[model samples]
Target: MPDYSFLNLSPAEFEVLTRDLLQKELGLHLESFTSGRDGGIDLRHSRSRKREVIVQCKRYTGFASLKANLEQEVEKVKKLKPERYIICTSVGLTPGQKNQLLTLFNPFILAPGDIFGRDDLNNLLSKFPEVERSHFKLWLSSTEILQRILHSKIYNQSAFEEEKIKETVRLFVSNDSFGDGLKLIERHRYLLISGSPGIGKTTLARVISYHYLANGYEDFIFLSGSIDEAYSLYNADRKQLFLFDDFLGKTFLHLKLGRNEDERIIRFIERIAKSDNKLLILTTREYILAQARLSYEVFEKPAIRLANCILDLEGYTKQVRSKILYNHIFFSNLDQAYIENLLEKSSYQRIIAHKNYSPRIIETVLENISTIRPEEFVSKFIGYLDYQDSIWKHVYESQITPFSQLILANLLTAGTPIAMNDLELLIRAFAERFASKYGIVYSQIAFNKAITELENTFIRSSRDSKDKLVIDYANPSIQDFLVTYLNDLQDMMGDVIDTACFFNQLVSFFAYEGPGTPSQRPRRTHLAVTPYLATKLVNRLTQNFVELPSSTLKKRLNSNTEPYYYQVRRSVYNKLNFLRHSNLYTNNIAMRNFTLEFFKLIMIPNHVQSEDIGHYVSLVIYFHNEIPFEEEKILAALAPNIETLSDYHDFKQLEALYTETYAKFISKSAAYKEAVRQMVDWEAENVDTLDIRDFVDDIHAIVDHTKIDLANVIIDLEEKFQERDRDYDPDEIYDHDEDVRSEYRAEEENISDMFDSLK
Candidate 1:
């Protein structure tokens, strides 16, 4: 007999199968099966109005072992007084088991072939392809469908439950939004549902897809984070519904997309709007979608604007949350004590009002209800909800292997998918370089095994359109948790220096050697590290370095950051904020002393953004008030390019530095004496008597001082302006004096002539 064990049908699922088989295959009018009152009769069938048959279904896999259940079912069937009856089971019965059952019923009621078993069910399924396709859909699905469903189910088990999906959807207690969403998609041809993490956007999309699938739309496809694949799945000729979950991106913090990906997505949606037979539905985190609106501006396009319908799932009512919690509790297998405890008015209200209450959180909490003590259940549930980071940390610490943890660290650090080949290279490279520090070694095969272990939990591997196995965190929060955990690990580990070295290597790898660029060899794959992740790793290094003693921080700070210039700048900016408020940091002689050198290292621009250049300069000047820099220190900080500097606040601070530096310089030393002498010479050669003030103003303009700096520079400059004639060449000075006298004598002669002529 064919093995139907792969079906793994539950009791309820088996009944659904039997009901469909009788009505679809047997061509009989049958009564529906009702739960809790089936009375051993799953169905009553009538054929040709003259013959009436009774049917019974037992989902038992071991018919021989369950003889008692069979006998009891037989007794219940006998009371129905049916002229004919058939016993259907998922497993075949032995001759002894069949003979015992045969003896229990009347000969007219039961015959030798009256019992149907696995072989019989297989044959029936073979005969009716439609029934197999619908009822045993998973077993009958094509490999592509099976793989897609299996892969998606690993990150989310909803796809598995989808096979035996109950009429009542769990976790999503309300259908009102789903109904409205469905109508919007149907009417507009496109819909984008946006919401927070774990707010049931995906669930509502699933329900909508399943509804269309039920309505005879055969080409249902799902895509996540890839518009090219979604475009490939689009079939305009057939009636279909396409679902693109998190289409804008996942991980709001690191939403790095392929170039022009947003444009392609907008174009795809525009195409869908024109197609009458095809429908599109998309979902994304609300903040991410909002960012997309700002970044892509696709929603502003007239065609897309008209076709788009956004449903935001925020501010869920308390009643809705309560209902959601109850739904999860109802479906999950919690102990009676736990269930009763959760049902208590106070316990129910506590979860409903908890700040962290969400559909996904509720599912996670209730699924582990069996492990929690009944007495501690309520408090623990609230605790887990309140601190989801703790839960993620525990999951990471408990479920992951050492090598797998390293891989996850890399993935989180990389901030995007690492292809299998590229991931192998990264693992091998890190092991060879830092094996002594992290205390582990991994061969390629061992690395493969480790990743296999993490397949569905911390990391997920999926084939992109190129058919490369790209690995990423199962979700964005997983990445966030791992990054945070690794930063904490930097402090907790005993080998602090080695760990710092390890993080530096990680920083370097992402900064330069990371993926996303094509290799020199044809067909060779490389994963490019995202800029966000590279910046994050550098930031991590800065964070680690700041906690170390002054000696260590200075030692690391002295190293050349030329290769990772931009990232180092951002990291330093972040550190400046961290150290800005702490008196401990502010007072530390080492940090205070190293402040100028640290600022100089990060301020050195290597193709950094213009705005960032301003930011770096600002960090130094803002902290200058506390760090106490001299004239040279001000010049050193301002020595880098300032034309690109645009931040007004930092600009104001930069002005303050110049003004304060000039004031101190004039009082303490003749720093500006030479420049002042040159300014005086220029004014004498270029100016007439009337233009002397203009020449003095020109000297002020040439100095390039701010309003604040001008006041102090001008005070010393005015005296120098009066004495400019002495500093000029002696002939130039004497000639200018003689010309002044000649002009005065000429004006006197004119006045005398006028007076004599008037007399």
Candidate 2:
């Protein structure tokens, strides 16, 4: 049972609920409206044609103070002279207070049992379930909540107009085969409804659920918690309708579940696919449904997936949109007099025909029109919806609390759904650090309260496949709102570096040593951020590269450890890939330079995994193409380690470029050739003592020597050659040519060995 103590209702709302209860339960005709005073009575009713009853509602909390309020109402009762008077209070009076009230009023005028309090109201509401739904709707599950919403004061049986929907649905045969879809559901026992938000998908699902409930379905189960919980709730022996809202994925934000939940869902589907009595109805946003198919491969299979039962509600005609808008507005709680006046205005036609109009937009405009004059509401609302910035600003300012703002900043900075517990930690840490900056001390209780508030509006929390609660911004629109809002705040405060570092710290959890043994250690409980999301966070954070501190960038580039070696390197590689594929930054010099520096920091001196060699080489290629000043240094550092290249396929491109560039540079350098010749002559003279490896090392060292000295060394070698030639006999000259050829071939073999070692 829900705790009634947690039920918070304002005075006017409580009175309205009381009036609804009285009207529904007592069969009373209310003669007075909720607002204006009718001789200080809240409601007037007549039991018989001649007998009048007066009701006064006081939502007082203090029992001691009830007598004072009662005395004031007692005076109004005496003046009205009703046959019966009833006083209603949210808090029941104490026994002494009640006895005191009874004694003050004349026994003939007021009876002892006429005073109704909270307990009495609860009993009345228990008797009228429909009234409870109509008045108090916030604290209920899905089907009940939707039932109350659909049958609200603005929308009721007469206002539903299913026939109009049916007529409109027929126009888009390919869009919504409503009859065929239902027929497929009957055959398959599973129906997946996919559509854009506010496109009548949930409304249609609710309509179907209502139909099944009307047809004697025993239960309406809204999915939450685990699939095991869902399985326990399902009864094959009874007729049941399971409403899985946003079944394919999250409606407001994108989140990836762990493999366990997907497998559970697949198993659930397998069971439901063969069921006869159990029916499952699922609704999801269109793109999310597609993503689900990718996430769960079984969803793509024809036999297990129930592919034929899928319905896409697209291709909505203008006439249908207008009808949908009209139905929502007609039954909405807008002021009837203002609605009537606006219906006559030509400006109203513009609202109906406006290209930007949507049911959600219209509903938002009509939700609270009491603050604005009815005559001007529609016109002003239409103008408001036309401006996207205005809507974003209004939504951001309206829903964002300070704690929630910090949450948004972190999520936006993280650019992924953070685990709920981890997110709370982030918020708490951020609050502690920026306490003086924000001018508020935050506690855990405050953080929890703020999170709950966010969940009701902009933030959404759901269990992933791992059964861990993860939180995300409700949708792409919310993300957009936060990005713009927080970017401005970050600019003014210059805290992007701080935010980036916080997320970076969280991501370092990915590098945790290991899960270890179960006997020695408990399971690791923390958010597991995907590599894809990590890449996204890095990309987003770097968008403010100019503002990022050098120290922060240095930390970002520190990916040399074993745990984060691949993850950070991949993040940088992915960013470069994005730049390569995208046109947004054709010549982003700062990003290019920053990424080059990052590559320099992450480059491996030894062998990388064969699988990752391609990614490593890609980073090298990016340096060669983008960072001219560092290209030669990067290649030279990598050149000595070419033997570490595990796969030729991974290094084929790099090999070709390195070879072509080295060959071209060598051919252009006469000084380099002279240096090589002198090194060969010196090795020939020292042939008996010199090792081939040592000789090759000396040749490499000479390549870096000055040109003038290399020429002098060559001249000295030529003089030695001339002196040797003069001392030799004519016959010995031929013998000398053969010896020189032998030495030259030996040196050539040694040079090839040096090149082979590099390979």
> Backbone clashes in each candidate structure, one number apiece?
4, 2
Off by over 4 Å in 1: 1-171, 250-256, 300-303, 306-308, 443-449, 462-468, 487-759
For model 1 the local lDDT of residue 643 reads 36
Whole-model lDDT, model 2? 0.51
Where in model 2 is the C-alpha error above 4 Å? 1-181, 224-238, 251-257, 260-267, 290-299, 303-307, 317-320, 336-341, 344-348, 354-356, 368-376, 383-392, 398-403, 411-423, 435-455, 459-759
Residue-wise lDDT of candidate 1 within 1-759, one digit each (tens)? 224542344343456667776676667777755433466666687653436688777766576655667766666765666778877787777777677777876653567577777677777766775666554222433343344433431211224443444422333444356656765676567788888777788877876665555555656666654565555444445776778877765422333344356667777776666556667888877766666666566566775674348886776666556556654654465667776666555566787788877686676666455557997878788887787666666566766677777777655444454456656765676677678767788786789889889877667776533344566666655654554466544322222222333322332212122344432211111123333433444454455754532100000111221110011233445445434432322333444455455765555435433345445565666656655545554444333323321332243355566776655553443433343444345444544332355555755654454322434434554565567546444342112222211110000112111112111
**Residue-wise lDDT of candidate 2 within 103-190, one digit each (tens)?**
7666523665666766777777777766665432222323443354334322101224444433322221121334545555666677
| Alpha-carbon shift of residue 540 in model 2 (angstroms) | 13
- In model 2, the Cα lDDT at residue 363 comes to 55
Task: Summing lDDT over every window of 10 consecutive residues in candidate 1, give the lowest-scoring window.
Answer: 740-749
